[model samples]
Target: MKNARYLPLLLCLCWGGQAFADTPLDLSHPAAPTVHVEINNVKGKVTIIAWDRNEVHVGGLLGDGAAPLSIEGSENNLSIKVQAQGHNGWFNWSGDKAMSDTELNINVPRAASLKVNVVSAPLSVDGIDGGDIAVNSVSGRVRIDARTPMLEAVTVSGNVAFSGHAKQAKLQTVSGDILAPSLGQNADLQTVSGHIQASGGPWAQLNLSTVSGDVQLTGELAPSGTMSIDSMSGDVQLQFPASLSSSVHASTFSGDLRSDFGTPKQPEHGPGSTLDTVAGNGNGKISVETFSGDLRIRKQD
Candidate 1:
């Protein structure tokens, strides 16, 4: 059995003439404090960290059969692109099959702006205090831990986890779960066929929507804040403190509606139910709607 495992390695070595090679990368460029950095990767992993220095440092490895990484633009604005040679068409490009992975570890100024784009490559960003940050990925897990002014992340078919403080945040995913345990002020979350779990926000405005995915929110609402959640065939649950002051309005068709604030009024002849009531002083506004899914509002323990 040990020889059987070596046989595959021997065949791989014979077929490719050698093992996969790694090309080291160590590059640095002088950059301004408010520089804008853009990265585009097609395969492998990308890790970005914020540093106090006013320069950009990139160190990583490029695997065999992968093209050389390219860095372009100037100090004020920089762009990095990882391209694979001779792979163009969509049907011909099997992600990381013919091309080797490209792993990058980059450090930039804390005050700089960042924009990243990836396809089938996991991305991670951490410890950044900066301007607008945006990441768009296709089928790659994205994890962001930053304190920025504005943040937007979107992915398809990969999970997203965010833990940071932002003035404004917008997160969206398709067929992938989202977990935001510590989100910031204004948040807008949306998903399709994926669940959402979030907490720890005194948001001024919060909106969550899903299609065929469950939604769970537990946090404190700001005074006079507005929260709205809509779902289609998915359950919704909201947990707030006992001292919450909010006007809750919930409606559902062919689904159960239960709340700890007040009793709901169900039509005696129809297939719909609604709850319109006020809790405490009614300083905040909460609205929830669902179709064929249960809605539960509970007080936090």
Candidate 2:
């Protein structure tokens, strides 16, 4: 009787092992030069590559038990999403009984605008050079190498790394670090307890903020550019070329301040310090404030 009862268990184990079927994916559709594309996946890696062709091609494996990809719209705008079987809405599951991991490798026109959302799937995007690119995730690391017009990427507890050019970019995280090797004309980066590191040239506007994390910036400011930085208890470091022309004003409540431009002033009977100096002709503006974190300003060789 015990052996008979164990047969059911053995069958279940066999079924579980073969439950996830790797369904092949091959779909193509005509696309406009600047078509808007959106893709959503809950728990699998998504890779988007830019192609010279004027059509969007999707080829990958769809996990069994998952619904067919919901592809909608026309050549100008399109939406692609993966959902669970018999489920009509999106669900972010992260435990036993979660959906099988589906992989999506999509190729779109180089100039198509793109957007992707996922719960815990890492996203990689490359070569997009038109419109805007936006990505959102719950806990998935995002990396982009695109020369788009605008970029907006946000995640919760996932790191973000960008290495490309954009007219305007906004990157944020709630406990994840941000690395931008080449910032755009205007960039805004924020995090909570996550470090921020960026480098670029002649930024017209730059905004950085963090709580309990460090901020490191090495770039150039435009002649009329403006920068604002705020932190509760994080260190801030700014590195600029020797030929920088900016008016800097930085203050801290109970932290040390060091600068290569000018000396920091301390009140006679206060627990705060300030740095009010001008670099070169002071054509730009910079403002920094912190609660209890150190500040360092240096010249970049």
Candidate 3:
């Protein structure tokens, strides 16, 4: 799910100095409570996940202002909005630029949804352990750590990394590295110009594709259907399980096939044996495709 909000995010820069609140807000409003917060910092990160308890926990810095950061709770949803006291731009033409706001962090229930869009800051989502997450960042690094059924993440100028088991996932970036802990036999991943890596644990769905990056799969995954991965300007290396079978088809317009496994039965199909021949015939699956990159399948220990 993609959210397109054309709103200008909070900008913290030097303008008019506002009074400072000696203390930050520390309160426990658990269970479907929506709390909003504002973080002022030149560099910071956000970590959110699902928990067994029913409460909302938040703690972060305030961009120099006597006015207390506003946190409004409406039912199960919490919104944390920061109001930078000064109207000055994030930085002046001085020696070095500095952020005029404080860093913001919050801990909420995993089942709750989050809407976080930042300007010139790094954003991270961990232990998603709950429902779907909708996030976007302009120049900050974006990351999601959870085992949800579905996940969608996008970043314009930062690296994207995911380390966990997932049922289904979709991630992309203009120029960043993409990594996913392989799924049971049926998982998929795609990217534009970064390296793609996935580890398979069971028999599920697997697909990896990239335009100008390398694709790698390292882990034990079930074999019934085909696992597909492709790269435009890089090599594709896949390390399969000991007992699984895979049908891989790879070809590069200019690069030669550098396969370490059995050669494909046909020449038209570069090299690489089917699931049935490697360790044993696959459970009887479908297809896997990798292009513009070298394809290598190794067994995991």
Candidate 4:
């Protein structure tokens, strides 16, 4: 029994180390804030939590119903090799069976910068602390929770959700919704088929354009810069704090325009379909245009 137990333990250790022995990656980039990670998951959620270090931490879950894999990293950097035994391309190009052979789990520093590239999988990042982040996917939802913002999120077929505060922000999505909060001076939002919702701080200059969805702005839009909103079939909602003011140039082609903050007065040049109202003095420019929906402006308490 002693010999049997010894033989089994040695065999297991040898087999584990030899299973995928041909992998080629250094998997280490010591003490770097520029943390890089690549995940190859056929299916399964990839979750990352940030730490306070200046290094990158990585972990992943791969294959469908595959054996659990433990991913280990010190400061920053992680790699997961695809199991070659799951490939049967000559017979089937199916991931269904290949999905059950690999798995991973890891923890990373929150303030470290990240570059994540993935294929056909949803990537979720929560409690990630710092640095600018870029996430690209074939088709997946990118969820980010950061304390401060320098995040640039792009996706082809998945929605993006960013939660935190930012100084300068830019977001592009092909067909996904964007929810971001507390942006700083300037922001550029562009999308094809999804809705955009943004709010908070130092609203210096805002430019939003969409082809098939609506645009909604809430909270305090700084009274200093230019703001523009354009959409095709959806309406526009602008909610402003009491102190915010702008040079209003708002109109609708086939839809009614209504304002609760009152309107700016226009100098009479032979009145036709023109209207104006004023408070004391206007601050900046606010332009709203829509094809078929009403423009509603409200004042927040």
- Lowest lDDT sum, 10 consecutive residues, model 3, at 8-17
- Error at 162, model 1, angstroms: 0.7
Q: How do all the candidates rank in terms of lDDT, highest first?
A: 2, 1, 4, 3
Backbone clashes in each candidate structure, one number apiece?
0, 0, 44, 14
Model 3 TM-score (2 dp): 0.70
lDDT for 115 (candidate 2)? 83
Poorly placed runs, candidate 4 (over 4 Å): 1-29, 33-43, 53-55, 64-104, 263-280
Q: Estimate each model's TM-score.
A: 0.88, 0.92, 0.70, 0.71
Cα miss at 103, model 1 (Å)?
0.7
| Per-residue lDDT of candidate 2, residues 1-301 (tens digit) | 7699899899998897777666889988899989999998888789999999889888888877678774679999998888888776767353213578889999999999998988788999999987699999889899999998899999998899999787899999999899998987899999999999999968899999999989999999998899999989999999999898999999999988888888999999978889999999999999999999999889997
Query: Candidate 1 or 2, higher lDDT?
Result: 2
lDDT of 3 by residue, 1-301 (tens): 1333422222222222233333454645645522232222333455555565567766766554423455556546665654433433332223113234456666776656666665456777666554655566656777777665556666666776776655666666667777666454455566677776666566465666678777777765464655555566677676765566654454445444544445534346644323224445645342444444555556566
After superposition, which runs of candidate 3 have C-alpha atoms over 4 Å from their true positions?
1-28, 33-44, 49-52, 64-68, 83-99, 182-186, 220-223, 264-279, 284-292
Q: Per-residue lDDT of 1-301 in model 1, one digit per residue for the tens? A: 6688799878988877655676788888898998999988777899999999988988998767666665678999998777665654322365447777789899999888899998888999988886679999999899989888898999999899988777788989999899988877799999999999998778889999999999999998899999999999989999999998999999999889998889888998988789999988999999999999899999998
Overall local distance difference test of candidate 4: 0.62
What would the per-residue lDDT of candidate 4 be over residues 71-127, giving only the tens digit for each residue? 344445554334324553212235444554333343555565556654455777766
At residue 34, candidate 1 shows an lDDT of 86
- After the best TM-score superposition of candidate 4, give how far the Cα of residue 34 lies from its true spot, in angstroms: 5.5
